[model samples]
Target: MEWFKVVAFVVCVLPTAHCASDAIVWCYHLPSCNDKTWPTISPQYCNGSRQSPINIVSASATPNNNLTKFTFVKYDDTSAMTSIENTGDTVKVTFKSGVKISGGDLSEQYDSLQFHLHWGNGSSVPGSEHTVDGKRYPMELHIVNSKSSYNGNTSLAVKDSTGLAALGFFIEVREAAHEMI
Candidate 1:
């Protein structure tokens, strides 16, 4: 099995009450709230150095022997995925608990929370949030997981640096096999 090539990007939007992100609505696609002003959408996350690593230079990646195979629990259960919606910026999928993931050098198992797809809002735009060799993929998928130790309490998970994981997968169109020959 192909191990998770990219594991974990800290998520920083949990609150003690009423859910963390319920209060603020971020306009991610607008020029007024682009990259430079993204932090304005959530200033609370900027005070620390522990949020998501927005991007990574693949060429600079270091090989780790430890990030081995991962065991997926209940990934096939369609019921695990509870909801899906368009948040204006991206399409997000919510999970119904029980699905979990382990191995991949993790000291403990992580609960599979949800996943979202990153694709162009329009046919003319590039969709993927990440790039390979300076080119963006047609689409991308981010699977968010939180350490089970937190007991589904996102408020607690957001504080720990290693409490959350964001697995990313780039979707690409395959070339015709006969054409290759």
Candidate 2:
């Protein structure tokens, strides 16, 4: 009789544990960027004194052979607005249809769907990479792309890593900028 009760309890509780949704929990010791506070210290911002400064020189410059050099003029434009949403610990930005990035040694024009930032949740230390004087950058921005021949089927490419091409840019947070939460 006791064994039957124990088996019943286990069966009842097991499904509940597995049914819970998986979510990324961000531990914020400071206020987040979306918080409506006045100049509060955020874990995403690094103060000037406690941060690592990046120094660049002209001698170590190398031209990018894989990237397309096109002027992106729709940083704040609404027409270029794509789908921006939070995915786990990172925020994803997807561009509108027919927004193409070209001008490199490639035969096909790559479409810009979205750009996302992968960062650590602390000041003076971001979860990214940057390069200075031929060194790797502390933070890197990945501009994910797919072949334009697919006709705006980037979602299908994301499912397959081989079908996707990504361009990375290293950046550092100098001051308190608008955080894309």
Candidate 3:
């Protein structure tokens, strides 16, 4: 009887161990979003003094007159999407050099690379990476761009401090679906 119990434990634990551990390592879902474990899995996720999803306080924000207003060039042009996919965490759309942005405080111009959306499970749960006064929105959109100097090499650009730029905006919940949908 004892031998049978030992065999049962091994059968149940050994085969399923890999599945349970892999889920946490790959997804890093809500259960493992803690500070303690996340840094262990991906150091980059927690590295650097500045972290994503920062809490922005509008009242305390300061405006710099040195920064000029930005200009969007050819942003309205119709272009075909190169790719769209669900990355388990978010849905992303890729474009082929359709738009560019210049001016503002940017030292160099940038071109649109891709856009992605982050969403929570339900209305009650906040999903936006950046919060306003510690508030979270149900959904957020991020348009990623890389500096024009990189010549469309996002991989190389991402390594530089000025290489990558991400514009994020919140999507408020509506009583009914919007006409744009």
Best by TM-score: 1
TM-score of 3: 0.71
lDDT, candidate 2, at 22: 28
**Whole-model Cα lDDT per candidate?**
0.65, 0.46, 0.59
Model 2 Cα lDDT, one tens digit per residue, 66-155 = 654654434456778658888765788888776665544444566667877656645544444323554433345666556577777845
Weakest ten-residue segment in model 3 by summed lDDT:
4-13
- The full ranking of all candidates by lDDT, starting with the best, is 1, 3, 2
* Best prediction by lDDT: 1
The CA-based lDDT of model 1 is what? 0.65
lDDT of candidate model 2 versus the reference: 0.46
TM-score on alpha carbons, each prediction = 0.72, 0.47, 0.71
For candidate 3, list the clashing residue pairs, or say none. 53-129
Pairing residues by index, what is the TM-score of model 1?
Answer: 0.72
